[model samples]
Target chain A: MTSARSNNTRLLTVFTILSVLFMIGWWQETDVSIVRADESDIGFRVNPVIPTNQEEKNASWFRLNLKSGDTQPLQMNVTNTLKKDITMKCVPTVAVTNPIGQVLYNQMTPKRDDTLQMDFTKIGPRPFTFKIPAGKTMVVTQVIKVPKTNFNGAVFGGFVFYSNDVNAAHQQSASSSKRGVSMFNQYQIVVATVLNINKAAEVTPDLRIDRVTPMAYRGNPAVTAQFHNTKPAVIEGQQMSFNARVYYRGGKKVLFRNVTNQMNFAPNSTIDYVISWGNTRMQPGNYTLRTKVTTGGAGPSWNLVKNFTITGNQADKLNKGTKRADYSWLIIFLIIAGLMLVAILIAWVYRAGKRSSVKNAGH
Target chain B: MKKSWSTALSVAALALVAAPVFGNVASVQAAGPKSGDAALSGVGYANTNGASGWPAAGVEPQTASGTSVAGIGFVAGDLTLNQVPVFDFGVHNIGSSETFSMQPVDSAFRPQKLSGNPITADTKANAGVRALVVTDSRAQMTQTAGYQVILQFSPLQSAKVNDSGQFLDAKGSATTDPTKFTYNTGTDNKPVTMSGASLQFSSASVNPSTDWNAFIGDSLDFGDKAAIYPAIYTNSGKSGPVPAGSMYTTQTRLAAKDAPAAVGTSIDEGKAQVIYRANMKTGFGTWAYDFTAPSSVTMKIPSANQQTGTWVSQLTWVLVDDPTQDHANPIISQLEQ
Candidate 1:
């Protein structure tokens, strides 16, 4: 009984001590991906979210189609596979480069934690140099500023991953010699920006005239033409000077009559161009005014014309064509007496045409 | 055995009188109701259903048979066993626009929890994130665009206990608004104007990205690598010398020969000027944290020797011969020691 009791006490004591030690070790460790003195998680956490694009290989960098107008700070996961206590900085950068080390855009990037700004350049293996702690993982992230160009395709940049897994790094590192650290083993994240983008060429603009009705007022004629620019972009995007000329049918060839006017076409705009056969530009006569507008480089020429006849002698414009007398009285007197004669003539014509065909058949 | 017997007897009596406490209470709950009848078979029979309930918070039971599957949440072994501490964060394309929002995986950093922490939402906190910039390539026109986001985080910095005896520097509460999000419209709002950020919400205007997901970052110091900086789309109908409004609007790099001069300096090469202010009262030197994992408390190794030299974002290392030997060279010291 004594022996059994002592054995029980010793077993319980050893077990209790072991339990306490386990608890202490658990409580004291700071495994960055797995845990810490207070936190047990410290090493790599390959987030359960599956890789979306085919370019997303094992331990490769990727481009998130994350576009935001807001400039707020953001945090992302540096998802890993290892479950060791580790702490790493998650940093973000917009590549001014491609995977093959071609410098696409070179800008000075600012450091996330410090006041330092990183100027991008070609290093040995990685695209950019970043710091990762021993036994800790680093998360690369940044608050994507809303870019001016909202792109439709994927961005081609290099996501250079670096680790202190090299022998030199391990030998030089002073932090946590006991925590078996995997000297920095790194590979560049050849992030193939897979994007589903849609784009369309802008619509071609053409001028359509609503109406070119020619009208006469006080023995003077004028032609009005409506013009419009139906495009999304501003038509007057470039500074353009303009001029136009008017022409008329002078017997055979068309004649030019300059319209003293200058105007602009706003992008997708509609405006009216009016040309008059008034005394200043033309005399009171039967004439056609053809208007021609010239715009700056590469623009199609505009040619439009309308004809109007002046009537009555109101002196504003002389009716150059033969003027008609007041013939309403003569026409009215004749129509009063012609109803019977018209009926007899119609009967005769019908009989005569039938007789001619019959005579030809008999012959 | 006597002590355990007395404790079990005491627990048995307490079961009749009061609540359970101390020494594997979960096990006691798992042991099931007493196998005897109370009140001489007149009182209530054994309450076998008690074992079917959920374990109390922070309690651990060895077996799962007694508890219902629905009642038991998966328990994790502590972090000491290389189970949960290693953390890695990155910007991954979770398919497309269908996914992307602020979500922190750790229990401590969930968006809702960060929103409630006592924080100093200052320029330093803002430094952790960068604005998106124009990423359109050279073409007659940059149509159909997309942006590249770079995430950064440096090692943590230890804040000294302040005058009030509180280890306070900057703490903050974070809230996210996924709306007010847009891409390159080629108008007043430009993506190129918003890349490589170092400051977070020191301003009331800064908001999270539209297609943002949860990322890990420091609550106090913005790592030279920690900020969540967004960038311009590939090509969305706008290019030809990144619009003057881009964040890298003015990007001029020092030549290879001139790079050494920029080793310890923070210079501005872009028009979006960012200023960094020191919090020290008296004269102070510029300071950066040593990114490293701490050792166990054996008390045998010297603390000065426990530093991991600084590397540029897990890439290049600018290390000393020995972290423990700050100024002393071991080669030279062998002659003197």
Candidate 2:
């Protein structure tokens, strides 16, 4: 009896320890090294053309300083280790700020912006194409002839190289027609070339708040303010501070109060800055969100106010049917506890029967 | 007896509970799909009958017994293209046949040091071999072997000129016409005739110094004197000068036919470059070719065939999978590996 009881206790103890360890494992985050099965074997590299006296080695991009109307000759030393020969088509493209707040230079067909006076297609080299022998290096040249008239600030553009093998690349981009089994991995890389025209120019940078959006960011409710730099000059050393408040229809009761500061902007770029609200339950109601932004110590400032209404149906849609998994540990623990209760009940019944049998033997 | 029964029941219960605590949690979801791939559908059960009664979100006892078949497929790996050289051959004396070297040069056509091209070639004795980089990751999977890479070049074709019927000259000056430039669109039977000036191609020795053996680590075999095969493909028995639109293949030492690459090993067969000399006829028009000519091969051009304005042609390089008979099964056999 004693040995059996001790065995049960030991078994229960080991199981309890195991359950705890399993729970901890489930709770902790795991980092798994996932190797992509669809990654392409084709690769290419763009090496910056550094002049004889320059110090940058194997730099990823190029920065050129030139006077207006000054013609500069630029060359890219390209190497192709691909097994097949490639007809590399080169085009000059302009960089613009995307909605996601990052600078994009690889837009195939970019819309013309009035603020960007210097045209990339005009000053850049004619579209050049050359064959790179497999495992051979070929040099492609582009001569940028700045307009004769003097201009200020910078002209942002990039020389884009593309592999004209659409058929082969397309084959690698899609897998067998099976429904769940699809794989694609052909991507293009762009080298950003920033041409800083002349050394010095005096210009004013314009800042404007483009839009404000309410959405979930990183699993938290937040408001993102999208802003843009309209001028060709880069906005440097500028500081921004804003106060955001939400009030009821008549501006009587305040519901949300947020204050943000020290937001900076890139040159000719747009950024979406998010301010998070921690798990605040929002109800359908009229609200007023007002913000005031100040730039630099004594430079400039802007005020923005917007009145909006949140519909009940929209709030219901945003919060209504979202579902999350229950904690695995909690469910497992409850199941274990219920099993333990049944085991205890069984033991009690067994003990009671044993006592009754012993008493009957005494009679 | 009663105590033993109770203890046995408790132990059985515990055993039953512990079975699924660690069954297959490691394979919960196959992570998210990468960009440009298939989007994620609704949640899938690793071991469940989805067709009969799919498990809803937060549904208990969601698993069912079924054989899951995860399929594996092939995609071309990302290869690196680095250090492409700009071939800017300046003006040529119309009557004289000028030979240009495909070596890295400054704006003045003088040899210069590039990122990948070292300075030892300045003396023209150890001239820097122009090379491109191609990295393959297909062999990364356990079932895959190395791939066979192939390269082909298109003939020099006509490019667009400005509306004024003028194109940029070598110095970016608008002093040329697109109509004046014509390539040697010759066949094996009917090669272009040059009266006085002729275009020529000269083959420079393949650079054997590149560290091709080290890129693939121990994954690939280059032993037994296996060597890269560099040749210009032509219908004329690959003889004389390589006609326009011919293919030039640089020799790459492959895995020895005797041995196969082990499974799950990726190999990079280092750099391979084919260098050639270009001797032109009717000197004004620019022509591009990978023509791996013999040391002193020349094609003559008659002055009557020459036009005054500058004419430019383009060279196109294309890298594709080697479709040769020997490489039909470029991947080493899995069983052999």
Candidate 3:
């Protein structure tokens, strides 16, 4: 009976040990799985993120018919919205596409956003795509510039944003006042106007010198001249530069005591300005004036030059001749008498030379 | 009989000494599992290159693939302050004690660290651990997902009146104001809203009796909730005066060039204490803070237009996130008194 009791006790102990081992193993496996499951959750998820798009603002594009080599610029705006545990980055790029889906201009690096001077003659109409990630939005655009020389094939280019870890994955967090789930998947484009210059400066607008008058002054004199911009279009913000050279008989600039302001003029605009030798006595003699005006934005497309002269008034002779020259009948009679005297001198000189030649022939 | 008892006792002692030898004596084993974890400093340092101080100029958000875009709220209207606050935060697996460490990531920025590593208590997941984050602006108690975050206030280096006005020790005492600092955090992982936010100084070197120039550094944890929407962090409840503490009474930094009759209520009132950057003069030690809002959210104060005054404002700051790190949460900076 004792041996049987001992056997029963050993059997019970063995069963208890097995049961405990099984439970422990089961618990460990369960724990491992739960822990691992949480880790797996950290992996990637296609959480519906916001999208980045093109910026749309009314930008005026200048349309000019020309060969090619012209390009213009447009800008887009970008914004970002994301919460904690997520960082966002952005890389902006720009590409111009034709109606047939061909890229004209491709730029990805951050560019200076100062207005892009565009030349539409070279570049043609093209669409742009801006692709960016979660953290930020961008304003990407293109500028059209008319190259000095024209090209055969039309090229269009715009700016866009690409993606990168810097602007996305480790997105900088937003402040509470501005915080929110940052708008994700950003993309946008801004459309702007393009200006085109198709013609040369000379034929486009020429400044014709009507007259240069040296007015009598108490001391100094004034040079009055006019300019005109004949082209149908109004030149915006055009600056004209000119050099004035005055001379007496010889080609020399007058030593004017004072000059006011740089020669300023507008396209198709005319004005009268002065060049005075302030309060100083003037040197009386035949004087000539030379003036030149530079074309503005349409550089070289509007270079202008004009030269003319004004006879100097004689000092004492001016007073003696003034009365007679001023008297209506005296002025007319002097003009007629001078012509008659010239005619009589020609007749007498012709007869006298003829008689001398006749006497030589007789001898 | 007593002698026999003594002999038995001697025999018993010998048996006790040799008991281990007779038993299936084996080599000593580890008390617990073989955990291969590194110890974590209550504070850790990280290199903050492109991620610290100010956002890179024209830095838009980007994606992991370096292809997509992410968004950040507008802080400095034109330029983003890509200032990444470096933090020593990671699991100390082996000696995985919950601890806090506050040392300067950059000495010129601030000086101090909290206890870190060797956790005060081990919590499997949602258990709470208290953490203090010292920034330039206000001090805050945060109830994070599994821990509590307390931001320590650093003295600002820019101020017209009291360049050292914001200088307080780790305990948050001041020379001009008697401070009373309180916490609105749950003992555990519950949201401690503003209502429970109270502050007072244990002691002050300032004259609190005659002049009431008390100042409190308050912070708001725009944690999971209110992460996106605009909310007001104030001194009093939602509508009370900005609880300027004694600073309001002392009114050291005049609200206006000329004093306002009602203090912050007149034409020169700041609505809330603030300093615009364009208005900042270099070398002026001002109040600074790091007002961290998760997921790149925006923060604003009440009054007319209260912003979560950040580093740029010289009021608050933020630490940048580096996804390459363990938890990637940067320690933000703000004021320097």
Candidate 1 vs 2: which has more TM-score: 2
Q: Residue by residue across B216-314, what tens digits does model 2's lDDT show?
A: 122121221111211111111112321221211111222122112111111111111112111111100111121111112222223333333333332
Off by over 4 Å in 3: A1-203, A214-220, A231-240, A251-253, A257-265, A282-285, A292-363, B1-337
User: Model 3: what is its DockQ?
Assistant: 0.01
Interface RMSD after interface superposition, each candidate:
31.7, 28.5, 27.7
Candidate 3 lDDT over residue span A1-363, tens digit each: 999999999998998998899899765433221100011111111111111221211111112344345343332233332322223222222222111111112223334222123322224333333333332232222334455563222212222222223233322331111211111111111121212245422223335555555542212234544434333222222133444555565655455422221122222323343354333344456665555455445554433334544444534322331212335578799999999999999999999999999999999
For candidate 3, write residues B1-337 as lDDT tens digits: 9999999999999888656433211100101101111211011001112221111323211110122112411110111121223222211232222121222223233211112344221111110111112111111111110111111122211111123323232355532111212112356744232110111111101112211112111113212111111011111111212121111111122122111010010001111111111111110111112223221112211121211111111112211111111111111111110
- Model 1 ranges off by over 4 Å: A1-84, A96-154, A158-363, B1-337
Q: Chain B TM-score of model 3, please?
A: 0.15
What are the per-residue Cα lDDT tens digits for candidate 2 across A112-166?
A: 6645677666785556666655644444557778887667766766666666563
List runs of model 2 lying over 4 Å from the truth. A1-41, A51-58, A98-101, A125-129, A164-174, A181-183, A198-201, A213-224, A235-265, A272-363, B1-337
CAPRI grade, predicted model 3: incorrect
Residue-wise lDDT of candidate 1 within A1-363, one digit each (tens)? 999999999999999999999988754332101101111111332111113432323211232333323222222223222333232322223233111111212222532212111111211112233332332222233222434333333222222322333312222331211211111212212222211122212323344444454533222344445544433222221222223234444564544332322223433334444344443323435655454544446855566555545444432333221123335568787886586578778888989988999999999
Query: Which candidate has the top score in TM-score?
Result: 2
Q: Which whole-number lDDT from 0 to 100 does residue A5 have in model 3? A: 93
lDDT of 3 at B317: 22
